[model samples]
Target: MRHSVRPRAAALAILLVPAVGIAATPLRIVAEDYPPFLRDTGKGLTGPYADAFRLLMRRQGVEVNYQTLPMKRVFQQVAMQPGTCALAVNYAPGEAETLIYVGKVAPITLTVYVRQTQSEPITNIEQLRSRPVGAINIAEIRDLLGTAGIAFTPVDRPALGIPMLNAGRFDAFISDTRPDVQFIGGRGRPVKAFTLARAERWVACHAAMAPATLAMLRRALREGVFAAETLPVWHSYGMDSFFLETRQQWLQPAN
Candidate 1:
């Protein structure tokens, strides 16, 4: 009877231990509706950045709930809420305190668009100072222009940038996503584009996120677990050139 009691006690101890990798709560992720990067397709979020993020979470066996929120709200919620994260964001000045960056998600190439008819030779960002410029109201873009002391009219979405430019509300439109600029090519007036800035976008969570979860993600990134899975998604979006790397520096553990 003692032998039987000992075996039963061992079984109870095993049962009492929580699952090693299971999360206490699903990770809550949020992103703005930026197409080709992140978008709500009515079925679900389906875009290169979204696909890559899902692959990363799935590999770690972590359950996640993704939501599409306005860009401003996405930044605010990820900054203020624990266990919450943003899908793709740039490292704006001073955000390092509130957010813990997990890994690089995508490459961003900020471009400025102006009507082809415009005779002004605007090769550099500073040249736009003489004319009104419009851009999406996001922190990264704001920081980019603000640092140069350039003021811009803010719109809520990329769709508004081109229209605002055509209506004379803005003289130039600047955006980071290529598809947004290409979207207006056939339907709208002809425009010329110039590269404004380039930077790597990242996945960031609030600093209060579980350390174990954060470590797990960083470990996955260092191990290159999702590289093979996500690189193809980048290729499909015609971004293999942008995403391909001989060495993913982000995959290296911090010094």
Candidate 2:
């Protein structure tokens, strides 16, 4: 009778737990429509960064609801909205006020997109001195270009820089490798990329969330980000030029 009684108690306890697991937490994933990085593929959210984030959260026992919001809306909501997080973001100077940097998703490597027929081949940023280049004012290399005497006109959007370069407005345009590669190639443009600096990008959450939430996230990043299971997450985005080890060494401090 004692053995039968113990078995029945254990079965009853199992029924009390939620199907996702007792420790699982509900989370919301937010991102701007940054392609090849974060975008809606109609199968929920799927991109290189978004896919990796989903896999990380799934391993951490997080049930996620993803939404595509404008950059303004995403910035407004993620800082104070509990259980909400940005999938991929750069570490800007002012963001520390409202968000805590939890994990680095990857490094953003900038490059130059030059039209083959119109521009000379270039190997480095310094070579562009006195050359008219189109770039965003806030790009990481802005200071470098300034000091190097490379002049550029600021474009309102990243994609705009591509066609402006095609129209011969500037010798080259600066943009991240993935997007510039995808955007330029997609349009059947002959623009080629020149490697630039690599900077860290991260996943950040609202500051108002519990400390335990951050701990769980950090632990997930530590255990799951570079694990064997994570490799497929990148390949799922269908990018062959995306190297696996490009930022692989940054995993330790990125957490």
Candidate 3:
């Protein structure tokens, strides 16, 4: 009876081992609606980062599911929820503790824009101190401008701000480098009016993510998912051209 009982116990332990392993580790990914980068296809989520993440995670043997929300809410959820991560955000000063930076998936630029017909050039943030510069409410752009002591008129979304600038409702508008141009061009609005800022963009992850996951993402980025040769598709999209150009400059072999 003792021999039979020992064999039965061993068999039960073997059966439970795989289940325990499966429950112990699984990957959950949180995404937001940042068009051309991340968008809901209705059938499912799809975008440049989404596609790259899927491929990279597969290589790492991790399964993933994506959830889309407003950009502000996405950051908030990631900060408050455990085992959650948000993507495609830039590294801002105060945000270091709130999010873990995986690695730069891409290089971005932040620029300020005004109507082409406007007589004066916006050479510095100080120029806009009293003027109403439109930006997405509660976004990194707002934070950056605020830190620089530049006051702005907050708007609900980037699209609204662009049109408002064109309509002369605001003196200027601030936006991510690529999207601003692409969005303007797509709408057949004047594109030559905008100028790139001196500041460059950096990719970052939520600080609340697990260190292991963050390290895995960093390794994957270094292995070159965001490399020029790997993601040429981004160039066809008007906005990502700026991102592609910046990536080339930053990732070039050091002489």
Q: Which one wins on lDDT?
A: 1
Model 2 lDDT tens row, 128-217: 776788875443667557767777887756667777777788887887644433544545364555776677666788988778878877
Candidate 3: segments with Cα more than 4 A from true spot: 1-26, 92-95, 179-183, 186-212, 223-225, 232-243, 253-255
Which candidate achieves the best TM-score against the true structure? 1
**Stretches of candidate 1 above 4 Å error?**
1-25, 41-44, 166-169, 179-182, 186-193, 220-226, 231-255
In Å, residue 145's CA in model 2 sits off its true spot by 6.4
List the pairs of residues colliding in candidate 3.
99-206, 99-207, 100-206, 100-207
| Comparison by TM-score, 2 against 3, better one | 2
Q: What is the lDDT for 82 in model 2?
A: 81
Candidate 3: 10-residue stretch with minimal lDDT: 1-10
Question: Against the true structure, what is each candidate's TM-score?
Answer: 0.71, 0.70, 0.70
Q: Per-residue lDDT tens digits of candidate 1, residues 122-218? A: 7887788888999877677888888889998887677767777777787788876543323455546536568887777777889888888888777
Indicate whether candidate 1 or candidate 2 has the larger lDDT.
1
lDDT of 3 by residue, 1-255 (tens): 000112233223223322222324556666666655666777566655566555555555565677877766766777777777666655565666786656656554556777767787776667878888776564567667877887778875566677788888877777663344444454424233344343433335556666777777676667334554334334323325554555667677531
Q: When superposed on Cα atoms, how far off is each prediction in RMSD?
A: 12.8, 11.3, 13.5
